[model samples]
Target chain A: MSKLRPTNRSILRRLALFAGLTCFVAIVMFPFYWQLVTSISPPGQLTQLTLIPDLNNASTDAYFFIFRERNFGRYLYNSFGVASLSTLFGISIASFSAYAIARMSFPGKALLLGLVLSIAMFPQIAIISPIFLFMRDMGLRNTWLGLIIPYMTFSLPLSMWYLTAFFKTIPDSLEDAARIDGCTPIQAFSKVIFPLALPGVFTAAILTFIYAWNEYLFALTINTQDAARTMPVGITMFQGEYTLPWVETSAAVVSVTVPLAIVVLIFQQRIISGATAGAVKE
Target chain B: MEIRKTDGSRLRKGLSERQTAYALILPAMLVIFAVAVFPLLQTFYISLFDLRLNHPTRNARHFVHKLNLEQYVDMTDRGRSALASLSDSDVSDDVLRRLPAIGETLDRLHDTLVSNPDRLDQYERVRDLVVTFEPVRESSLRYFRISGLEANEALSLAEQLQDDVARAIAATRESPSRQLRVLEQISQDVGRSIVYPNFIGLGHYAAHFADTRLWSSLINTMTFVGFAVLFELVFGMLIALLINRKFLGRGAIRATVLIPWSIPAAVSALIWRYMYDGQFGIVARALDAVGLIGDSSVMLSTGSGAMVSLIVADIWKTTPFMALLLLGGLQTIDGTLYESARVDGARSYQQFFRITLPLLKNTMMVAIIFRSLDTFKVFDLVYVLTAGGPANATETLSVFAYRLMFRQMNFGSGSAVAVVVFICITLLSVVYVKALDSDMLTGHK
Candidate 1:
């Protein structure tokens, strides 16, 4: 009976906790809400500072304005193309390297781990000058391959870290069983282990996609051509003709963010796990 | 090269484990090398010389002195034809007397330019490219490296010819101003046609060491990283603690909070810049309404205000990520321990200090190390939002390096800045490894 009806003190405590959590979340998410409100409003009433815009007056005219005026579709294609290619290449490359590091007891394993670790910590600016020059000389400055190569390289460290740890957690008994059945290590990895590690590879895919999608420095440097810019560079250098640029920028942000926000919403747990890969112990 | 062991259980002969492992990682190592290691070495190598792409003579990295043969040939060839016309009967005797000496100097310079057999060969090819214009592309073929003594001899001859031209110019003051100007310009062009070797060993580093901009940017980087990490940790802990408990809207709260971190940094900068806008931003108006500032414009205008505003945005953008990390750490804590502490009548704060804080140290170390290095290399946020603006109070090392390397096209100094950033991050990593744990290298908790 007492458990069914909590005490006033406990009720108040729960209410206070809920209220605090709600307030903090609202504060954190208010920027996105504001961006939405600003993006939905027509250019005439954009600066009205209304929490709830007059629904009858609000219009998503700016979305059409961005696509029409700016070559936003090109940027969208470039971002998606570059990000997907890099993620695909990054996953395959990182998986092989990570499997060797995790499963095999071999010489030079520690040195290889150290090499990849430092490459992970290697700052992008340290190599930007030479890369820009090299890409320009190679006639790859405005191409997708140029961006994909660097993106793939930088994404290797994180994917390798996550996949190595994930592979280590899988029992060795499974591989031994497969080997006893006369399967090679590669055959076992593909036939038996690879299917089980799909969750980890999926997590790495999401993270690396996000990385290549959000990468600004390389994209800004290499792909300065109007048609080759990614979403980040496009929105940063956004210029709208009729609608205000800020609103169009907000619309661009909204368009790209909606797809990603859905991914984050659906995979928040996996994303968190992937993010805190090496930071937390099981 | 298959070797079958006599007593092996498996019958088929294939690659050894060591060879297979090496083969597996060979592609990744090559990619990393091509992208990261090779470029890093190239940048460091380029930093040793004064490489300026915009300047005509100093564009390429040269080891020895060279003459800009295209411009030198064009100027002298045109001067010879134009000066020959000035030797008509109407020209003054004083100028006429000096004319042969100038012509003789030009002939001597031509001989000296192609004097050595080696230079003569290289210069003839370049002269063919310049002189034959239709077949060969002259753009890529320029700047032959010449000997020091030849360079000195050619430069002295050019100087003597310029002095003779000046004397002739003074004697022929009756000539048209345009003719005098053309004569003066030819002499100047002839004098300005030598490319000096721009080999400044360690000079960029030494000069940057004394530069206040470098030191102040370092200080700014430290200040930004310190405060951002500190606030993110505190707020991240609070949020982590709050969300760790059983709640109805926990999923919604977690997902909603992650939206900021999921948003691109450049986009986050855009949202914050809008929210911190003086006239139309709701946050600005609310801050003004609360008397937090004299006006809304003050947030983005003043240096401290801009820093504080950006810091607040950074905290908002990244605190969720930090919280998510701490929450991962928090979940790994055995719940029964907390329950035992509660049964022992220990208060929540005491339980936190004794149990959670001590247990969360490793996670904190890893999180802080990653975040600090990342924030130290912060470019997109500062680059898009403030752009080291108002007075450069917000300039970090990455931003400074970018401005020098990309915007100013000063690759040498910019690379020095980049190397400084790399060193500082390395120093920080060394400190963390020494102070935190050796497990960092192993990527083990």
Candidate 2:
């Protein structure tokens, strides 16, 4: 094929592909670059029309302002606490259900799976107000549990799906052999299959944690008080508070996103696989 | 493939595995029911009645005609005492003759509260709280909700007494004393005893159907979904094909591609918002230089510009995930099919059309429909970026519902908007389910 085509034309084609890929990569990355630049830029330089970033003059004052004056430290603490608890709860509950769905053939197994799929996709807006009402009635408003329960439950569908697919990939013979060794079903599962399914559980927990960490609507509605507000809601509140510098918003966003970005980068393979787990059966 | 899942479990079912399975799944199902399903049902129920949190009397769902005894008792009592203390010089002879009737009317109303065996004790407790100046925050104690005939009579009587005070105050303007003025002021302060029935059956739904805002948002939502999914599918397919090819730095490239999808949506919105800033946004300036946009500010400052900006941001953020979905489909295509086609002397483009495109159709369809559904319920991005701003020209249904429920405190209308969204999504889901009636759904082999 190289011999058939002219050398000049082939070079042009190669150059075009390289440029397209470079442009795509640039498009994917420029926002974060802009975010970093904006976060580091001081209030005086925020409105400057310079396209290039100024790193030497960068300041951490915006970060300090958010932590000190805006109570973003509380929001960060709240987000971490809620996301961790939600992941823990989601992982624990999903393990058993995933095991059952993957292992046994219950009567309503098909029906249950269908229901789970839809519930996983249930729109949060539909339930936001009712949950608010229930939270108020249960005295859960501005409480950690108010946000935790919804986050954990909403994540159940995906967690269960991935865990089920993960559990399915594990052979049943291990547990069968454990049963033959005089172990009960629970004991066999704990000793044999659970160990094999640990990776799936971890992956499910990562996804769930990300889901909880990124969540804003429930956090905003349920946790109205500064004591319980999460990072996403707290940062949005930064605006309309005496017309502060736009740099503060950038600082808050970078602080929240960088950790998640780092984690996702490290676990990119597992996260990617977990997302496409059962969706592509082939 | 695993017939043992049926026969094997049945043969070794000594430990009640069915019961165990149910028990294991019970907690997850219960949580889902409580958090999602129950609240969703409750939202539907709330949408039937007017639940405006900002409105004092209509904050909660009212089941019957109710009296606000706290305000009623205090104001009526003040009116009667103020009228009785009036001097002879303060009013005309006719008004003096009418004073006893109005006083008796007030006492009778008070006597009803004090005399009723069911309400007398509760009324006294409420009176004590009012006198001590404590806020009756609890609705159960403050609002006297009843379905009895007394509810109607008390409501009418309160109105009549208020009217009488007005008449007396107007009639004695010539002798204007502070006593009658106090009575008039108290009567004016006394609110209606009849609590409003906020139950508007299908009223919100009907009103929304007629609302232009809802239609505009629906248009915005569909436009965003349509354009986002379309561009995502096409570009995602191209990216998937490119990355799926053998490359040296493929792992690094894949990780780079996953950045947008990995970052939380709200953070993505903020990043885009900064870059699309009218005056200082780099991307805006770039677009202006390329003549893609007339100006940098128009993207967030105009309706068409905002919509286009939203679609572009969505495409940028989600095309990576879309590519991943398609890549999953791409990997499933047997490699030998391409080798065999090459042996048949088929060109690369021909092989792609014959071997790859046909096989990738299912994943493409499913990814598009699923992506469409996700885009339909977008709130965080639109909310954080523009907040349906630039005069709310960018408001989608979810944004509209958020404003109605949380911002406007109209849960009823908001829930109505929610239910409308639910119905639309459920319809789309049914289509998704129909498309997914394959072996993957059954999970057998």
Candidate 3:
């Protein structure tokens, strides 16, 4: 009876703590939830300030406006193209470099590792001038290549670093076994290690994609023309020289961000693990 | 001859192994060299030249050739000839050798007069040079009459020599001013002409270090990062510890806390900007209700208020991230450590200090570094919230660099600012890496 009484009291205390946490979480989530609601709420009712949109007032006018009036589809396509290319190119290069750092007994491996990691720490603003000049000279400005090239600089370092960590966790014995079977280094990496490191590759790919997608400074600086503007750059158009359309802007924000949120939700576990693993040892 | 077949096979295998290794690492190295290192070298090269696109004549081969050492010697000879023609007496090499020393003495005298206005009459030579240089140009005929030296007779050659000396001093003063004006004009023109040029130098960095505006912006950035990180660490730790125990619907609560972290930073910034808007936002309404602020309070209009609002928004968005990291660290601690502390008759506070704080150091450091770096380069939130406005009170180094590079088209200074930020972050990164290394080595064993 004494044990039961204490257990009952602890259960009630646990319930109270859970309720408090739920409230805290709701407060944390309110901004995103409000953004979603504001995106779908009818234009006239957007300012009503309700938690949920009235069923009769719900509409897709803001999204429709973004598509027809704002040329948002083009921006989305540009964002997808640049982000996809950067992620693809970044991962391919990082995978090889990561392999070299993790497995090869190179003379300057420590210096190379330190240099690569240092690149990740640099702020893009500092290198903007020289990068802009280089882009202009190469005839890359106002083109997708201008944005993609610099975006690679940011993502490649991160990909190389994280992928290096992931590659280190894999035992060398696996690679040796393949070599013993007369498989060359390339074949061994492809046939044996590559398949095993898919999760890590996936993690790197997602991170690279997200970083490129959300990157604003390089995109804003390099690509001034609308044809090559990414989603984040496109959103800046809502703040006109004299006026800001808050409602339509919120709607546009929802459109681009929802897809990212969905991706995060789907791959939450992998992302959490990858993020913590990279961070914990830093 | 018997082992020849085995030897050939071994040689082929060795060659193939080298080739495979090269193929694996070559592409990444090439990309890094082309994209990162090449531009850095190119920027360094450009900074060495006095290249400005605005000087149309200077763009020609003749002007470029004229900048050589031979042309500079020719200009010096011509200046000497001009002074000699006015004096009507050939100045000897001995006098020319003493000219620089005499000029330095005159400059010191002038500086003393300028600093103390009462000392003006004490420096007669400098005063004569300043007064007569322009009048001598206007009244070339009167130059000899005023000094009582006949123009044709060149009477009292020493007085004519004094005139030459004054002219030389005047020319020296005017030459630097003229060069400065020309340089300024060229820079202004270049600023207007270049679309985007890779300019690399420390000029902007020096200017920023000297300017009070840059210091103020840096202080604001540090203030924002320091307060936000400090508060987030404390609040996030408390929240994480509170929810560490098993609870009903804990999963739901944890998922909800992740919403802010999951939301795009840009969108959240915009949302908070709206919430803090004075015209009819939730923050203003709540503050009014509590009588803490007036109904007409514009949270973002005032400098302190805007800073506080920015800090609040950042804390809201990032506390979840801090909590998540701390929660992960909390889970790693052995519960038996706490049990033992309690068995030793320690209070709850003592147990937390003894068992929890020391164990959580590594996780806390990681969180602080990440958060501090993110806050250091804060652009999206500040850009969306204030645009570094209300008289440029909140302009961070990044924002200032952007305005210089994009708005004013001053790539040189902008590049310099970028270098400063890079150096600062690099130093921070070194500290972080050292701390992490020590933490890992200590914690693992």
lDDT of candidate 1 vs native?
0.85
Q: Which candidate gets the maximum TM-score versus the true structure?
A: 1
Q: Report, for all candidates in order, the number of backbone clashes.
A: 0, 0, 2
Per-residue lDDT of model 3, residues A5-31, tens digit only: 568777796677767676787777776
* TM-score of each predicted structure versus truth: 0.92, 0.90, 0.75
- Indicate whether candidate 2 or candidate 3 has the larger TM-score: 2
Q: Candidate 2's residue-wise lDDT over A1-282, tens digit each? A: 646866897789667766777788888987777777888886687667355866678788988888888888998899899999989988899898889899876788898888898986688999999888889989999988888899989899889999998888888788777877778667877989998888888899999988898898898788999878888788777777445357888888788777777888899889998887756663
Q: Per-residue lDDT of B168-202 in model 1, one digit per residue for the tens?
A: 78877586444445666787677567778888888
How far does residue A6 in candidate 1 sit from its true spot (Å)? 0.7
Please provide, for model 3 over B181-217, each residue's C-alpha lDDT reduced to its tens digit, 9 standing for 90 to 100.
3322322332111112223245445666899877887
Q: Report the CAPRI category for model 3.
A: acceptable
Q: Candidate 3: global Cα-lDDT?
A: 0.67
lDDT score at residue B205, model 1, on the 0-100 scale: 94
Query: How many pairs in model 1 have backbone atoms within 3 A of each other, for residues 3 or more apart or on separate chains, i.e. clashes?
Result: 0
lDDT per residue as tens, model 2, B1-445: 2224677575667347787889888998899888888888888999999889998678878867777878876777667567757744545875686677667667766665445666777787787888888877777888765555665566566666777766666666476678877776765555455477788889999999997989989998999899999999999988898888765677887888888887767777877787787876777777988999998888889989888889989999999999999999999999999999999999889998998998897788778777898899999999988889888799999999999998899999999999989999999888777766653465446
DockQ each candidate and list the results: 0.57, 0.57, 0.33
